[model samples]
Target: MNFDKRAQLIRKYDVPGPRYTSYPTVPYWKNEPLSNEEWLQSIHRNQKHFSSDDVSLYVHLPYCESLCTFCGCHKRITKNHSVEQPYIDAVIKEWQLYKSAGLEKSRIKELHFGGGTPTFFQADELVRLVHSLLENQQVDPSEVEMGFEAHPNNTSKEHLEKLHTLGFRRLSLGVQDYNPRVQKAINRIQPFSQVKKVHELARGIGYNSISHDLVFGLPKQSLKDMLFTVEKTLELRPDRISLYSYAHVPWVKRTGQRGFDENDLPTGEVKRELYEQAKLRLLDVGYLEIGMDHFALKEDSLAQAFLSKNLHRNFMGYTTQNTPMLIGLGMSAISDSWFGFAQNKKSVEAYIDGINKDQLPVFRGHLLTKEDLVIRQHILDLMCHFETELGVHDSFDFNLNVLLRLKGMVEDRLIEIDGNTLRITEEGIPFVRNVCMIFDQSLQSSASREGVFSRTI
Candidate 1:
């Protein structure tokens, strides 16, 4: 398709939509009928299906030295190092509370550090935090897949070496755009040289996988600018790449994205062309699309997971491992127990106060209904495999009304429906969020959709 036509299509379909990171999608989560006791029971019940070696842990480090204009993630902006110790101590206390809830310590199989910039903490502090968790748990480091996000400008040799010693094999660095103007607009001033140095340092420390995050459709971004970023990214030769569309939702992110004007950003057509251009360039350089917005080399774990049909998606995006129980620590983190989802308090002081009072620090959550579970499974399949088998419905009480709603999408050539299976066609990749929307009963019934989601395109 030509850029004009593609842009028109995006304009037509780029309505408000959820990212499908979670089935209930946070906004639709039922805040009532949930308590910390119910949350713990859900985890305990789900843990019975797998041994301790199958659990995954997600730790949220919410501090960042500065704000990035296009970011919508939960974060605390401050350059002071004084906040690190108290936050780390609170995280340890939170983990101890989980341990006290009867969760077995030996069951951890994965540990991922997500952040406002996990590297915002000093290297030794990070080591101390990880060691504290290990000290209280009976975890086997050999079986654990440990990783963290690193800011290329601040990630040092000591950081890499110390994290490597702690068994972190993977690292993801944010390189939103190599263009200096775009970097300046986002308030993240990182040079290509700094990124290269971090990449080389990570490799020198024997890190197995390195991923770079790039963005398209940012304010003041052009085709030439995107190509420049892609060319520079190719030079780094990272194992994985996440090419994300810059979601301009100033209503929610408020101060973060307010730096740039809407007129300065590309329109739908230009944005689509930018994505298509980057996609072609990446494929030419041997990166396979693992799922929406993510690409990996053929030999990388992500690609291997895709080939094996073992790919999974969670709040952390895509992963190779599927764990029914995930414990999210720190402020504003959400933990998914398959049966239910729980989110912690968003304020650091509130989190600390709750933990000090010996509480779970969870402020809200939802328990999945029977329909929710079925829809969630299908969404997971579509997101991971680009197709899903509806045959699994024979054992569940799913309403066929949802399938009837997808007929229009099938006619639009966005998807193919065949003998109880629905597959997203190549033309439908960009509209994956729309296809998932067909099954979102809550969203369909809601009166206010505009305030709840960002654009799907």
Candidate 2:
């Protein structure tokens, strides 16, 4: 599509909405959270269905030496190395809680370390953490995928080597922008040299899938800056690229984003243009768009998954791994039991205390109803594959109101509905969230959109 057309569409459809990482997204989850016992039962049920099958694991290492003003993730900022060991110990204990809850022992299909910075810990400390989780367990080495988020400024050669030795084949380096003004605005001023060094180190250590993360619409960001960032990124030739829209949600993350002047941030058309510039440049360099806000080389597994319709998304973002269960360990981590969703205590102190008491540390969760499941599947289909089919399952009664609500989208050529199937047109891909919202019974029931989500653009 041309720039004028995309800009026009952006004006028409840009609105606050959930990314649909989870259908009946967290804010719309049932008021009565799932109990600890209920959460465990969901896990047991998952295990029963996929007996001895490998499950996915997400470990939250929520510590960073310095705060990135643009970051919205749950993290504690401190320079103290003393806290690392205690946090790692608590994470191990939390994993054991799931083991006691009947999670398949030593059988993991995918493991991801996300955080304030997974590279915050020393090399040996990471080894200890991975060993503690893998000890006496069976991992699907052939199919097992392990990865982590790294800070280019702090990630060391030893960190890459040690993690690679532990079967971690993927690394996502946070390189939001290399523009000095933008970096200063976001309070994440790592030089491009730092990122390049880390990238070379990881590649030399045999890490197969290295992803560079870039963000548009940051405070003081411009089309030129976005192009420069993508150009510099292509010079490194990462296996994957996560080109994201910088979500400025001061209401939700007041302190972390306080460093910048919101007035200086790009908005509306300018922000959309920044993304289009990045997207075009990346595609020119042979990177294929995968799902939303992500791109991968044709040889990358993410691209392969996208082509095969096997791509999956969860709290951990996009992945090729699909498992009935995902166990999240550490503060503010979330677990998916296929039938339910549970989140750990947000505070490190509270999480550690709960773990010491032999508790699951989950303070909130939601058990999906049949209808919720059906809607969840449709949303996932649209988000991952840009299409969905209704009335294909007995669990759901096809709601015509959805079609009625989306009538404008059809008229706008953003989507097509033929019989029981719905497909998002190429022009509709950017508005996939808006398309999904038509089927969101909860959001529709609430009928008030103020202060609930970031804009869909």
Candidate 3:
């Protein structure tokens, strides 16, 4: 199909869909019967799978100096530096509880620092925190990969150098947009000079990978504005680029996105055009598409992961490793033990209260059923590998449910289905979420349900 036809399909199919960061996404988790004992037991049972050294760590630092209106992440917008030490203390305490539960520190293969802004903390504080973690754990530096998210406006050279010295080789800077008008609308007044400086600074300090986080479909974002952002991004030539579609979920985030009206944001066909133009521009500048909403130059590790078929997806988005055990520390973090999923309290006060009481901060979780696990595998394959084959199983019968759902998509030339295997065609690339929704049993069951997710297109 041609661009015009593809554009039309995108407009028609670009309805609300889940990002599928996790199966039975967080909202669907049943927390009523989730107890600390069950969570710990699940962790122990899943740790056995890490005998070959396959575990990942996600450390969430939820503090930020200010709130970006377009952000949908869980965060506490505060300027008080005093909040930092207490949060770090709580995180370390939580880690201690996990350590006491018999999780061998040697099994950790990847560590990622994500949050409102990891660079919000002082450089010395970050160094101290990381050092303490390394001291308590038996981490293999050679096999470990560590990275963090930084705000370009406040990420100083010292911050980059300090983190780099502490085994952090990858850095992601949030550069949502370069347009002054768009920035004002989102209340994120970051100058391109600052972003460019930070990008060069990270590369200059020998950081292996530097990723720029860009967003499309924001309020007042036109094709020209997107072209400018892409052109400016190409000039910097970061190692990786995460081109995200702006999720306008005011009903969920509430206050964070209330500054602007929903109608001001780009809609169906226009939004699709913005993405297509950006993709073409990035490709022309030598960026290789790596799965959904992410692009990496040929030399980047993510691109290499694609080539080796080792690319993996988790709550933290794309990863290079397929670790079975992921332990999340800090406020509102979610832990995946392969067999189960647990999330800490979203409130900082509640997280602190649990830590002070010597309790695991988790308040909710789900133990994956046989069907959940099977569906999760299919979703992961489609999200990371872009293809999946169904296995004959007692719980889920292999039939035309998926193919039947894809029939419309197939007619639109969005996907092509073989026997039991399905692959997202090039035209379907932008609508990957729509393709995956065919296998999303939970979503289908809750389709009539209000306030679920944003459009997949």
Candidate 4:
């Protein structure tokens, strides 16, 4: 992956594509209503394959006092602190509904609190929420992998200490960047000292596996800004670093990304360089690259999983644990039963309304077809391990037509086809999404792909 070759590939492959966080993505899902019976059947099917005790839980906290213009997550903007307790109560009720609907699995193997900002709620509010979630029983911190997303500016020492006491060992701080210009453009104005304080506090509180989120291709971001940010990140030496590509989809996010001028964003090669150089800096400092844009130390669980080719990517992005059922509990949250995908109401009011009716709150869903199941395995393997084998699927035909579609990638040295196996080259790491897209029959046939996704490179 030399500089010249990298630049050429970036220019050639810079096209709109889904992030492949989920197979059949969301747009390709059927638009019909998700019935209660259908969702239950999916859950029953999942239970047959997975252990009843092993479950992954994702709780989405969609409240943020201030808006970070670059964000694409579904969230409610408000300065009102009163929205906190009510929202927690609604989420707890939703969890109860899942239990009544046949979600008997109680032992959570992986639990993550993600949001507009998980720290937006008061410390006591989080306690009540988690207590109800775990059935008012104290959990052994070692029994579960608990993590949360925090805004460094708002993540107080009390927040860290309280969460640590409740079995939360992982902390992901939204550093985004240390560059003031980049911070101002994104409207997440936190100083380096503020982030430093939070990082030190989390470590002092005995939290493990700290991850810092840094974005490339941001508005007004330059090579110097990236270097400085990387330098500051190294100062803290967090366990994991997520070098995310800034998805500037103003058309989709509407007003969220409209605050900053689009012209200021780095595109194509410039955007790739920001990541490439920063990746080099991270690798030089002993950080090993994980799946996609994530990097971690060798001792980190994510890094260990990657080394063993067991890393997985779902709607939670990349994760160490790949449960048979991932139940997302919150507004706009998505649940996956391995063979089916269901989403809750997008609007906060609608979500709360549906929950009050003693329902699952799922509005739409898709049951995976035979072809979808085969393609999903291929995409998941490619995304997590950078390779896949044709022999895995007995019913699906991995024939000449599919090979013809991937000929361009093979010729460009982005991938190497060894008999019935296909592997992404080191240079092809950036084009993993493109390779996966070719196998996506729905995306390939969909005319809506132009605006529905961001650039792959």
Q: Model 1: per-residue lDDT, tens digit, 75-116?
A: 999989899999999999998898888764546678899988
Which runs of model 3 end up more than 4 angstroms from their true locations? 49-53, 136-142, 392-398, 447-449
The residue pairs in collision within model 3 are: none
State the local distance difference test value for candidate 3. Answer: 0.85
Residue-by-residue lDDT tens digits, candidate 4, 73-185: 99999989998988899999998988877765557788899987889999999989888888844588777889999899888888999889889999898888888888999
Clash totals for all models, in order?
2, 2, 0, 0
Which scores higher on lDDT, 1 or 4? 4
Estimate, for each residue in 1-457, the C-alpha lDDT of model 2 and write its tens digit: 7778778888988888888888778887763455788888887777776675578899999999999999999999999999999999999988887777776364788999999899989989989999999888655555789999999999998898888878898999999999999999999999899999999989888999999999989999888888889889988999999988888788999899899787998888889888877887788878898888889999999999999999998889999988778889999998888888999999999999999999999988888888888888999888888889966762333476776798999988999989888999977877888999998878988977768888888
Clashing pairs in 4: none
Residue pairs in collision within model 2: 106-137, 106-138
**Candidate 1 Cα RMSD after full superposition onto the native fold (Å):** 1.9
Deviation (Å) of 192 in candidate 2: 0.9
Q: Tell me how far the alpha carbon of residue 432 in candidate 1 is from the true structure, in angstroms, after superposition.
A: 1.0
- Model 1 per-residue lDDT at 372: 85
Best by lDDT: 4
RMSD of 2: 1.6
TM-score of each: 0.95, 0.97, 0.96, 0.97
Q: TM-score ranking from best to worst?
A: 4, 2, 3, 1
